[model samples]
Target: MLSYSEQEILAANVNPATGLATDYLNLFNEAIMLFEMGLDMPDMAEELADWHPRGYIEHFEKSGFELKDVVIAAYEHAPADIRGEFDAACERALTMFDTSIRVLMTANLEDPAAHADLSDRLRDMKGLVVEMDSHIHGRSPAQKSLQSEVDALF
Candidate 1:
């Protein structure tokens, strides 16, 4: 588990600009709070549903979620002449992917049979979007189809 001081340092490193830093800082802090709450209790969905989106806790709960947040900040700072737009889109996809992972993780740990279905849905979405990335630059029909599906998901 990450300490508050560590999280703060990470947030500072990830968000340097004074203008828009607060939003990014909030995002990371919220994720960390939700993750810690989830870790403390197994019924994460219930614990976080009132606080935020159901899957957000799980999505931001992982070790790599902070890194992904940094990636988003970099995309936000990228030059217009560079691949900023594409990078931002990719970052969005990754955030969605992480959210899906958290939802699936919670669903798997859920006792109710209904949650299993939710888990399956999240897992399917994650798998589809991740698989589509490999073919993003390709012109094959399969690649085109996957990209379409991934875009729809994002």
Candidate 2:
């Protein structure tokens, strides 16, 4: 369904075969950074709480990513089945992240057990990002892990 020329999409940093981009993953990175940092710095909790979920196109539109338009168009044109799987995976990651934040907000980071548990949850979130990264790179990602990871983490 994507009509963009190979040159154009690649120029925009999108993987032509997958019609997917990596810039979107950077958004997840920000959340991970904040939460991971929050584990040690109690003050970061306020900043981490502001992190919220956004879908692919919405993420690009709101972000200052240089190739926002191209990324949005490519995502819109991505194959239905792949996109659906990707979106479901993203939704799972999003839910897990949001839930982790809510739990972190109430948890006392100073406590050893709570701190360790949230760290484990954050690691799973990072794993989901790796899965997303693999998908964008046109690698044969084990998509099943996306769901199972969410099940274990969420």
How high is each candidate's TM-score? 0.30, 0.85
- Can you give the lDDT of residue 65 in candidate 1? 53
Residue-wise lDDT of candidate 2 within 16-116, one digit each (tens)? 77778877877788888788878888788779777889888888889887777888889888887778778888898889889998888789887899999
Maximum-lDDT candidate: 2
Give the per-residue lDDT of model 1 (tens digit) for 32-143. Answer: 3454445435566454453332222233344355454543444345345333333343465456645743664455454566455554545554444443232222222245
RMSD of each: 12.2, 5.0
Worst 10 residues of 2 by lDDT: 145-154
lDDT of 1: 0.41
State model 2's lDDT: 0.79
Q: Could you say which candidate leads in TM-score?
A: 2
